[model samples]
Target: MNKHNSSHIYGIRSILEAIIAEQPINKIFLQKGLKGELFMELESAIRKNGISVSYVPIEKLNRLTRNNHQGAVAQISPVKFHVFETLIESVLASEKNPLFLLLDQVSDVRNFGAIIRTAECCGVHGIIIPKNGAAPVTDDTVKTSAGAAFTVPMAKVDHLKDALFYLQSSGIQVVAATEKAEDDIYAVDFNQPSAVIMGSEDKGISPSILNMVDYRAKLPLMGNIGSLNVSVACGVFLYEAVRQRINQI
Candidate 1:
């Protein structure tokens, strides 16, 4: 999908309000050299909040939003976010081995929503996504998930690689679900604290993240199709984990 058309907002006031509201503004474009109290206030807030910003010509901003944009535009997040640590802690406190799913760069909303629904049904503790590469949790995603978006806790990280590191440090086993692995996913014991990482349909997990993962496994396939849609792959892997975990009791 064209990145620009995904989701965006315009008008200095609207952009500022989105920032104030703590919406995940992917990037902002402001008319070149424009400055004012509100601009300065928004600038300060944007910098403090770590939102990416770029100064573009008025024509560029106009192209993004032809309405009375007032020289600024921003992209908004569709789902609420939670801190990863809090989710991990909550799972630990409950004596549940956390089952988390991390999306490397799955930008398709339907696939994302479908995965989330499967995750929730499999008792996944949370879903992790990168701040930039993943799809925005748009209304389409919520609808596709059948409102599972509201039930599932998702955490956005500045860098998914770093988040994997943090998860490892916190004692969660990171598993990369890719075709590269020789061992089957069923080979691993999933009852431990764990997180599964799935990649975009076009591209599998990023190499950097794959390197960090503790184990790499794949679902045995005999079909003519070389690959399964990301959402379908997620369901297979997560349900396998659920089956094993349930059987252990």
Candidate 2:
């Protein structure tokens, strides 16, 4: 296996070493039904770092690396994931109005890249994604982002529903984007300190999270397409914030 794969960390020792060195690990995959001292050590390291991990079949681990991964592989992120509390503190301390983007299980790497590019260009203070289920930043993602992925500040959180609550408690209006919503994008007040949650391409926002939203807004579609691509929808949502902030609309 190429040591330069950027996304993968093969072998149990190497994975543990990376964690010990404070590498930005996106996720870890372990072979199902496997247990040993090394595995226990790895699990402890993962818990200590709060890294997302999954138990998969050996075949899946083999597919990721032909090298002796020792039934474990870690995915390293290209950019260091920001700390949510630190990011919020900094944003709140800033003189400018806060504009944050919270992504809910948008699993496509290319889409993640595009959203990062758009969010950076739109001057979003930060991007928040769930630690599990979200796509890891890879070379393809960086290329798709036009290098914006490295510049944009992003926080990987434990759960998205909890994130919405935190944002609300911090005095930021939390708006969710969903087709089932009664209001269009214009109805929400984005000029204030705000965060907009964009769901995955397939499934929209979770019902529990959607229920907690201060507002549910949609982009009216005049065309025949049932829905827009998640990245495109994200761009539209962010630019609306830019427009609102520019015009104080």
Candidate 3:
């Protein structure tokens, strides 16, 4: 799913209108060294909405949309992003045991969609991803999730580490799935209010975020391949929680 060829709005004015309307913008590509009142207004709107913006050359904006982009192009997200605090507060208001999924730099759109689908199926309360680096909710992603993208609550934050910290402070256990952990996934208790952090395919979880997590657990690899696709691993973790909760009741 290349956003370079995805649905986007061009022209600074059009993009500003979208921002003002609170449309779900996945990413904004602005021309480097751009300046002017309109650009200032666009920047202000972006900051207010917390939209992801990248300062790229005009050529890059042209590549995204060759339709009179006027130095700014914004890709629209198919699914609206929930605010981290608002999402958590809503879950707290529910009084049900919370299950949140956090993706650390998971860039593949298909994997992201599949993870969200599985999260929905497993009764995850919400999904979280960094505003930058993570894949946006595009049409293909929504298709891959079979409409789960709209059903599941998803949030985008400035940093995964801060979200992790906030989740801990809110009394939600932060469990990171990584190969580096000594404890196996089976050993970790997931019946508590929990947020599962799944890392990228190639790099796994970042060391800094891993250091902040309360517990690190891994799935034992019986096969020689030594890895599982991130979505598959995520489903395994999520269902484990489901299983634990079901039995507890």
Q: Residues 1-249, candidate 1: write the lDDT tens digits.
A: 112334788877777777777776666788899989988887898888767678999989878776777788886656668877787778778866778899999999899989988988998888988876678787788889988998999988889988898889988899999999999898988989999999988989988888899999998899888888899999999999989988988
lDDT of each: 0.84, 0.88, 0.89
For each of the candidates, the C-alpha root-mean-square deviation to the true structure, in angstroms, is 4.5, 2.3, 3.3
- State the lDDT of candidate 2 residue by residue for 186-215, as single tens digits: 888887899989998788888888889999
Model 3 per-residue lDDT tens digits across residues 78-134: 777888899998997895689899999999999988998999899988999998889
| Best-first order by TM-score | 2, 3, 1
In order, how many clashes per candidate? Answer: 1, 0, 0
Give the C-alpha miss distance for residue 226 in model 1, angstroms: 1.7
Query: Compared to the true structure, candidate 3 yields what TM-score?
Result: 0.91
Query: Which is the winner by lDDT between candidate 2 and candidate 3?
Result: 3
Please state the error at residue 183 of candidate 1 in Å.
0.7
Worst 10 residues of 1 by lDDT: 1-10
